[model samples]
Target: MVDSSKTHEPLLVARGITRLFGNAYALSDASIALCRHEICGLLGANGAGKSTLSRIVCGHLPASSGEILFKGAPLTAGSARDALRSGIALVAQETSLAPDMSVLENIFLPSYALPGRLSFSQLRHKARAILSELGHDHALPLDIEVRRLSTAQRQLVEIAKALALNADLVIFDEPTASLSPLEVDRLFDIMGRLKSSGKALAFVSHRLEEVFAITDRVTILREGKTVAEGVPTAGLTQADVIRHMVGRDIGNVYRKAVSPAVTNEQAVALEVTGLHAPPIVRDVSFTVRKGEILGLGGLVGAGRSESAEAIFGLRHRSGGRVLVGGKEIAPNSPIAAIRAGLGMVAEDRRTQNIVPDMTVGENLFLAQMGKHRGFGRGHSARRKQAHELISRLGLPTDRMDANLLHFSGGMQQKVVIARWLLIEPEVLILDEPTKGVDIGTRQTIYELLREVAERGIAVVVISSDFEELLGLCERIVVVSDGYTIADLPTSRLSEESLTLLAAPRSSAERNAAFLRDLVAGHGGTAFWGLIDEDRFVCLAVAESARSAPMGLAAGHVYLAHETAIPLALGRRQPGHVTESDGRSTVLTPLSNRRGHDLGWIGLSLPAGSKLPNAETLSARVAGLFDTPQDEKIDA
Candidate 1:
C-alpha cells in the first residue's frame, strides 16, 4: 500500500512535543510527520492527547516542550496567524462558519478579513473556483446562506475555504460526526481529491471504521504518551486497534447469555403488539422470554430505537400495547415503565444516558433511589454500593469523587451501564451498550448483561453490529423501515442473510442485484461470515489464529478425544465442525466439568465417520454425562 503520489518532503513535522496540565501530563515526548499526498489519522479514546497535539500543531496552544517544523522552517507558538500565513489550516469539530453570511462569503471570509480587503465580487469568483477544485457541486449556488446548508454541505464549504487559503496542511477534527453516510462518502471523495493534489491531511475521528477506511496510518496515544505508532490500515481489525488502546484482550466482547432455566415457563416478561412509529418502524410485535437475550438489528434509523422507546414508554406511539409480566403497561412515561420492571439504556450516552455533573456514586444508584430505606439511602450506604459496583465492573476509582466529565469517554459509558446494573430490573433494554467504550470495557459490559439475565431477567439489546447480535442473542428479530422482516434463531442467521434482510429492499431483489454484484466483486468469498451465538465462522482459520484471540486464552490444537467434554454446558459449542469424507471431524469443546467451553479442540478425518476407538470414545462420553449439569465455569 505504498502511496506513489507522495513524492515531496515532509509537509509538516513535530518533534518531542509535551504538554502538562496541573500535575498530570497531557502529552509527552510525542512526535509526528505528515507528507503531502498522505492522510494520517490521529486516533485515541477521549483525553488521549489527540486534541492537545492538534492545538499545538495549529499554534493555538503552547507546548511545554517540543519543536514544530513546517517546510523545514521552525514554527512559532500562540500565533495562529503566523501558522496560517505559513500555509497551515485547522477545521475544528465545532461549527465555525458564519450563519448569516452566504456560503461564498464564509468560504473566503478569512482572506477577506485580511489586511488588504478584497471586493465581494472578486472573493465570490475565487470561492467558486476553489470549491470547484475541491470537487464540490456548483449547482447548489454559493449564494445560499450558511445557516441553511446541511452539516455535510457546510463541511464541503469549510474544505473549500481551506483550498482558498492554499493551505499545505489541513487538519480535520471529527469532521463527519453529524454527516449522513452518503454525505460522508462525498466528503471522502473530496479528501481523495486533496490527497491526489499533493496536500497533507491529519484527521481525528472516534469512528475507527472511518479511520481505517481512509487514513494511510494511525498513531494511538494512552495516558498522554505515544502507546503505539505507525499502525498501517492493512491487516488491521477493530479488535486489534482496541487491544492496543485498552491494554487487554477483551474476550468474547458479546458475552454468552444465560440460557433460560425452564422453571415456571408460563411467565411473560415483556410483550409488545402493533407498535407503530414514523420514518421506518410500523406495526412491530414481539415477546421476550424470561431470562433470554432478544436482539434487534436493522439498518440505521430503521425504528429500532423508536420501538425500544415506545416499549419503554419513552415515545408517543400511535397504536401499541406493551405488557410487562402479563400486565398491560401504559405508554409515553418512562417512570411508569420503570415501575413495571422495565429499564432502558438509551442510544446516545452523552446526551440521553448519564448525568455528567453527578459523582460516580450518585450515578450508580440513580434508578434505585426509591428502593432504598427511608426517603433515600444515606451517603455512606450509597457509597458502599458504588464501591461494590466499581469493584465488580472493574471501574477506575482513583478519582471516585470526580465528576463523570473528568473521566474518559469509555469510563463514562461504563458508569452509564453501572447505573442500570444497580437497578435490577426484570426487563432491561440496552441500545448500543458498547458504542464508544474500549474493548476491555465492552467485555465487562457484556459480562454484566449476562449476569443480569442469569437472574431470570429478560434482556433486549439493539446494536448496529450484526455480528454482535448474532453472537449474544438467543433469538434475533430483524427490523427494516419499522417492519419486522425476519425472526429467527441465531444459528439460522449468517452475516450475508442478516445484512440482506436488514437492507431496505426485499430479500429477493437484494439477492438478484446487490448480492450478485457484491459476491462477484468480492471474488465469491463471504467476507462478513456467519455469526452464531458463541462463535463466528471465520475465513482462513490459520490466518485468524495467527493474531491470537484477545485475552489470556491460549490457542491450542487438541485431539477431539484428548479434551474433556463437561456435563450440562449451556450454549457454548465445540470447535467449528467441517466435513471432508463420511467421517465426523469434530473440534473438542473447551470446557470444565461444568460444561462451560472456554476454548476449543480441532480434529479432522479424511475417510470413515466412525470413531477411531469406539470403547475410548464411549468412556469419555459416559464420564462427561455423569458429571452434574449444574456445574458453572467460574468465568
Candidate 2:
C-alpha cells in the first residue's frame, strides 16, 4: 500500500555495507533502502547479519566497507551521537539503558543532544505523553529504577526513548518480542500513525505474522548477504520469507508425532502447589510428568519467571510447596534444588546464566558443579557428557575454549541450555529460552527440547511469546497477574483464545460482570470467549440459578460436538439461531477501534426459554468495550 516508486525520496539508504570483526565478516554486501511513510521489515535467521546492518545504519557500529546515505548526506559511522543529532534512532534489541536511572530520565536521555536548557518538569510531562501514546501511560512509574522493571517494561522504555527523539527515521529491533498480543497491536497502531505522518521506520523481528501485519516492504538477509531487497510485502507469503531466510523449505516448525501428547500417566517430575512468592507469584499450582514439555505462559511481569525462580529455589517462597520426584525440597536453597534433580535457566541469560570471562566449556559445565560433590568443579568428570551434549546441540566442540560472550545470541542460548542438560536433571526449566533467537535457531532449539523430553526430562519453558508456547509446548498453564488461571491442552487453544485467557484481571472482571448482567436479564448461560471450528474456549461465564448449562466453563476449552448448542455455534450468526435440540444461541464479535478481533460474547437459551433479542444482545456487547465497535460474526 506504500508508494515505493521513485517519486518519493528515500529517507535512508545503505548499499553494499560490510562489517568485519577480526577475520570473520558479520555482514557482507548488505543493501537496503527506506522511504518516508513506509515501514520496511528486515528479516533473517540468526547469524544472518540483520543486527549488524541495523547497528551500522544507526551509527552504533561502523562498516569496514561501503557507505550509508541519510537524507541525501553521508552518515558518520560509529557515531551514535551524530546519528541522534541527525534524527535517526535505534530501539536496540538488547536494551541500551542506564539501569540505575529512573524511567522518566531514561526517556529523555536523548534530550541532552538539544542546545536548549533542560526542564525536568517539562520532560516528565512529555514522557507521560509518549507512554500514553504507547497505551502504557501508568504501567511504568517515573521514579522506579530501570533495573527493577520487567523485560517488557524495559523494552517500553527503549521505545519511549526513541519516540522522544521525534526522529525522521526510526529503526525498531524486535520491538514486539516481549509484548503481548494486545500490546503488539497497540505498537503497530503507533507505527501506522508514524508512517502516516511521513516518517520512515524499519522493523526487525523474527515474527513473520507481525511483519506481514505492519510492514509494506521486506528486505531479507541470509548468511551476511542480502538475498532480497525492497520487495513489497504484499507479493510474498510466509513460506517465501522462510525459504529466503534459511534457503530451504522449512515446513511445520512443530512436527511432533501425531500420537497423543498426554504424558499424564508418567511419573510426576515436578509439582508446585499453592506457590506464593508474595506480590509477583501467588497461588501457582501445576504438575509436570516425566517427558512432558509443559509451558508456563503469560504476559511479562505476570509472575512466570518469579514462579520458576521460586520453584527452583532461586527466590524465597513466602508460602508454597515445591516437589521434585515426589520429594518436597527446602525453600531458598538452589543447591538443594540442583541435588534434587532440578535445573533452571533464568530469564536474563547474560546476568544469570553466562559468565563473560569464562570459557564456553566452563560455562557449559556450570550446572554440573552444583550437582556434584565439589572437590573437582565437575568439568573433568562430565567431559564425555559435555562433548556429547555439545555435539547433539550442533555446537562446535573446538570452540569450547573460546569466550562464551563471543558467540552469537542464539549460540549463547544454546550453550546455556546445553549447560543444564549436561547435569541430566529430571526437571529442566528454561525461561524464554528462545527470546532473541531467530527462526532457524528457533526451529533447532524446538527440536532439541523435544529430544530432551524424549529422554524423559520434564521441560518447563516460560515464554512471553504465545506462538512459541503453542508450538513447542504440549500443555500451557496460563498465568495472569500472578495466579495460575488456566491449564489447557495446546490442541484446544488458538492464539486469540489464549490472549483472552491471559488478559489482565481488570478487563476480565469487567467482562465477568457484563456476562452476569446479561444472564440476569435473559436468565440463560452467558459467556465471553472464542470459538474455533472444532473447539470452543471460555474466557468468562455467568449463569442464572435456573439457567441451562451450555457445557462450558471459564478458562476451559471444549469440543463443539461435545456441547448441546453445536448447531448454534456452527452458525455463529449475528442473530439468534436455534439448534436441532431447540436450544437458542446468539454471538456478537468483539473487536477494538482499530479492528483487532478481541473474541466473541455469546448468550445461549434453554430449549423452551424465551430467547433474548439478537440486536439488543449485540448492542450490549458493543457497549462493553470502551470504544463502540461495529460487531460482525467472524465466519
Candidate 3:
C-alpha cells in the first residue's frame, strides 16, 4: 500500500552493525534504512538483534563495530542525551521511566538535560497535550506517581515521553506487549499521524498481525544477522515472516495430542484456599489436577503473577492455605515450598531467574543445589539427568561451560526451565513463560510443557496472551483486580468472553454499582454476565432483600435450564421475558465505543413487582460505558 517511488530520502541508515556480549554476538552485520513518511517493521525472534540495533542507534549502548548516518551525515552519539539532542528517541520494550517520579516529571525527563531555566508549568502543558493527542488525556494523571500506575499505564508514559521530544527518528520496541486491543488501535493511529508528519519510525514486534496492518517495509533478522532487508510489507505473508524469523518451517505451536480427561477423583496437585496478599492478591483460590494444564489469564496488573508468587512462597501471604500433594506447606519460604514438591519460574527471567555471572551448567543446577543437602554443589548427582534434559531440549552439551548470558534469549529461557525440571516437582508454576521466546522455540517449549503434563506434573501457566492460554490449557482461571473471578473449561470459553471476564475490577465495580442501583430501585435481583446459546457465565450479581433467589452466582457457569430465568437467557432480546418460575427478566447487550461486545446485563424481578421500561434500562446500561470520545474498557 506504500508508494515507494514517491518516498523521500531516508532519515537514518545503519550499515554492518555489530554488537558482542562476551563471546556471543547479539548483532552482526545487520543493516537497515528508515525513510521519512514510512513505518519500517523490525521483525525477528527473541535475541535476533532487533533490540541490540535499536539500543545502538539510540546510544543506549555503543556498537562493537558499525557505521550510522542520519540526514546524510555521519551520526556519533556518546550517550542517550546526545541521541535525544540529535532528534532521535527510543521507546524501550522494558519501560525506562523512573518509578518514584510523577507522570509529568517522567514525560519531561529528557528536557532536564537542556541548558535553560526550568519551567514546570510549560512542561505540564506540553505533557497534557501529548497525552491528549494519544487519546489518553484523562486515563493518565499528571500528579500521580509512576510506581502506582499499571504496566499498560507505564507504557503510555513511555510513549508520551518519546513524543515530547518531537524526534525525527523514533523506534518503538514491543510497545503493545502491555496494551489492550483498544489502546493498541489508538497507538496505531498515532503512528499513522507521525508517519504523515514525515517522521521516520521503526516498529519492533513479534505480533505478526500487527506487522501486516501497519508496516510499509520490513527487515527480518535471524540469530544476529539480517536475513531480509527492506522488503515491501505488502509482498510478504505471515508464513514468509515466520520462516525468515526462525530459519525453518514451524508447524502448529500448540501440539498437545488429545488425551483422556482426568476425572474429579484424580488427586489435586496444588490447591490455594483463600489466598490473600494485601493490595495485589485477594481471595484467590484454584485447584490444579494431576497431569492437567491450567492457565491463569488476565490483563497486565490483574495480580496473576502475584498470586503465583504467593502460592510458591516467593511473596508473603497474609492468610491462606497452600496444599501440595495433599500436605500443607509453610508460607513465605521458597525453600520449604520447593522441598514440598513445588517449583516456580518467575516472570522476569533476566533479574530473577538467570545468574549472569554463572556458567550454563551451574545455572542449570542452582535449583538442585538448593534442594540437595550435601555440602558439595550436588550437581554430580543430577549430571546424567541434566544431560538427558539438555538433549531433549535440543541443546548441545559442549556449550554447558559458557556463560548463560552469552546465549540467545530462547536458549537462556530453556536453561531456566531446565533448572526447575531438574527438581522434578509435582507442581510447576510458570509466569509469562514465553514472553520473549521466538515462534520456533515457543513451539518447543509448548511441546516440553505438554510432555511435562503428560508425565503427571500439574502445570500452571500465567499469560496475558489469550490465544496461547486457550490453545494450551484445558481450563482457565480469570483473575481481575486480585480476585479470582471465573473458572471455566476452555471448551466453553472464547477469547472475547475471556477478555470481558478479565476486565479490571474498576470497570466491574461500575457495573456492580449499577446492578445494586437496579436492585434497590426495582426491588429485584440484577446480574451481569455473558451468554452463548445454552451457556451463561456470570461476572457479578446483586439482589434485594425481598427478591427471590435466581440460582445464579458470580464466577460460575451454568446451562440455560439450570437457572430460574432460563427463558430470558435463551432469548437474549432487548425487552423483558417472563420465565416459568413467575419471574420477569430483561437482558440488554453491552458494547464499547469500538462495538466490542461486553456481554449482557440482566435484571430479574418477582412477577408482581413494578418493572422499569426496557428501553430506559437499556439506555442506563449503555450510559455506564458511553464516554464522549474515550471508551476505557478495562481489558
lDDT of each: 0.64, 0.84, 0.85
Better of 1 and 3 by TM-score: 3
Give me candidate 2's TM-score against the actual structure: 0.93
522: Cα error in model 2, Å: 4.0
Q: Which stretches of candidate 3 lie over 4 Å from their true place?
A: 1-9, 19-25, 63-67, 94-107, 120-160, 178-198, 213-216, 232-235, 532-534, 559-573, 576-584, 606-611, 626-634
lDDT of 2 by residue, 135-233 (tens): 676567899999988777899999999998989999999888778776787788789999999999999999888999999999999889999888889
List pairs with backbone clashes in candidate 1. 249-551, 280-481, 280-482, 281-482, 282-482, 583-609
RMSD of candidate 2 to true structure, Å: 3.3
Locate the minimum summed-lDDT window of 10 residues in model 2.
Answer: 626-635
Cα displacement (angstroms), candidate 2, residue 376, comes to: 0.9
lDDT of 3 by residue, 92-181 (tens): 887899989999999999998899898899888989888877657765789999987766678889999998899999999988865645
Model 2 residue 123 lDDT score: 89
Q: What is the lDDT of candidate 3?
A: 0.85
Tens digits of lDDT, candidate 1, 490-608: 76666555654564433223123322332233222111122234333321121123222212111111222322211101223333233322323333332335343223323233233
Evaluated against the true structure, the overall lDDT of model 2 is 0.84
